[model samples]
Target: MKKLVFIFLTLISTNLLAQRPQTEQGKGSLAFWENLTKLCGKSFEGEMINASENDQFYGKKLVMHVRTCEDGKITIPFHVGDDHSRTWVLTMEEGDVIKLKHDHRHEDGTEDRVTQYGGTSSNTGMSKVQFFPADQETTSLIPYAATNIWWITLDDTTFSYNLRRINNDSSINVKFDLTKEVDTPPTPWGWED
Candidate 1:
């Protein structure tokens, strides 16, 4: 009787866990992705809340356009002043992972040497926040940036992009106001499609 009771309890426990709500580990589910997709085809003007001396270049017109929204990816072109050479490509990876890559291109539609460098989410974060550690590719492409960590946050009113160096005193944040939609910016470089 004791053995039979133990087996029954074990089965019940397993079934309960199976019925629990899906979470970050639910690879096919993307509540966070859906939140971002809501901004498709929209543009927002952002102000650099925090910046180091190196980020002075972005002091010009800062705009982020949620340009493309597809099955499992989003392409946002970040325009800094008159330079439209940077695009942030976020793609869903292998179920529950989100990968963010910086695609940089030149005027003649050629890949820049310092392009395609970004990181993948380290955990299944909440729908509002996702943290991406420096991936191997990013480290290899920019050796000094090996200890970098980037994250983006999406809330009802504001969407922010942030970068920080691990154990270092370097960081920058650009926060866009989602409450007001701005005029869409021009197409980014190498994006005639």
Candidate 2:
């Protein structure tokens, strides 16, 4: 009976510790997420390349325009393809983590892409974001490869979306250093209504 009581107490203590959020640095204020979102309002450019030896067709060059208002309304223009034809929407998913959801949008305000995509803030508090592809199962999304890690670094004026795509377990990784463009280009490729 004494052993059973000690085991129950240990289990309860472990459960309580697990319930607590990680606060080694500070409270889970999620300041990193906010800072990353700020990159959207201005004109920025980035690239998405394949991390494979076979060379897959990923967005090579992209111009991102993140627009936001005082009322908290926001929109991010994501251009893709060689002609820069497609536009993907980036919206904030209100929660503790400040998740960003992406989807293809038409002029009529409908979804165009067959699958939805976006990313969630990492709980590790390491200033990282996870990219989520719609076709992937939820269980497989968290442990995303380093290539899927779109490391966004920004200054007061300029920003860089260091998009990386990890193709294999080896060292060959495709990299795109998307620097901010001064002028905004026309609407993306598939902006038609």
Candidate 3:
């Protein structure tokens, strides 16, 4: 009877452990997810701090609205001037992994060819920062962006979204002031008010 009880207890314990997220990275991802969710329903103004004159975002008004937050996903619309086609979607998957996806849409509410291209967090990023490297889907969708790596950092005073291309010197950083909330922009393309 003792032997049977021991075996049963061990099996139950193992199964419970298997069901939990297993890595330190997973815990960090959860922390990051919670921090991001706190910004839901807020909008902030930002600017591309490193954009060159030729960049599309240069000299344009930038706004990011943390519009939606639900059980396992957060959607933030990024408005660049009058164009309302870009959104950033963050999803919390099983094992506590976080996925970042760029959702782009046409003015008529149609998906763009380069839509839904981003990656997942692969390391133990902190509660205020996370990094995502280009996933296979991103490479398959945008051949030239195979080496892209994107990161977002948040703090009491600022929130920054950044991208870097591996093996290349190209990069962009957009910083939004967290000290003040801006007027929320119009609904992004394909999303209702």
lDDT of each: 0.87, 0.46, 0.90
For model 1, state the Cα shift of residue 149 in Å: 0.4
Model 3: lowest-lDDT 10 consecutive positions: 20-29
Model 2 misplaced stretches (Cα beyond 4 Å): 1-30, 37-40, 48-60, 69-73, 81-95, 106-110, 122-180, 188-193
lDDT of 3: 0.90
The residue ranges of model 1 lying beyond 4 angstroms of the native Cα positions read: 1-29, 52-54
Error of 1 at 42 (Å): 0.4
Q: Which candidate leads the pack in lDDT?
A: 3
Q: How accurate is candidate 1 locally (lDDT)?
A: 0.87
Candidate 2 C-alpha lDDT tens digits along 1-193: 9999999999999898777654334334244445546555566665443344354434355566664423323455555434443343433345443344445556555556432444454533333433433223322543444235344443454444434445554332222233534466565544431
Clash numbers, per candidate:
1, 7, 0
Q: Tens digits of per-residue lDDT for model 1 on 46-119?
A: 99885645677555888999999998889999998888999999988885789999999997778999999999
* 1 against 2, candidate with superior TM-score: 1
Query: What TM-score quantifies how close candidate 3 is to the native fold?
Result: 0.85
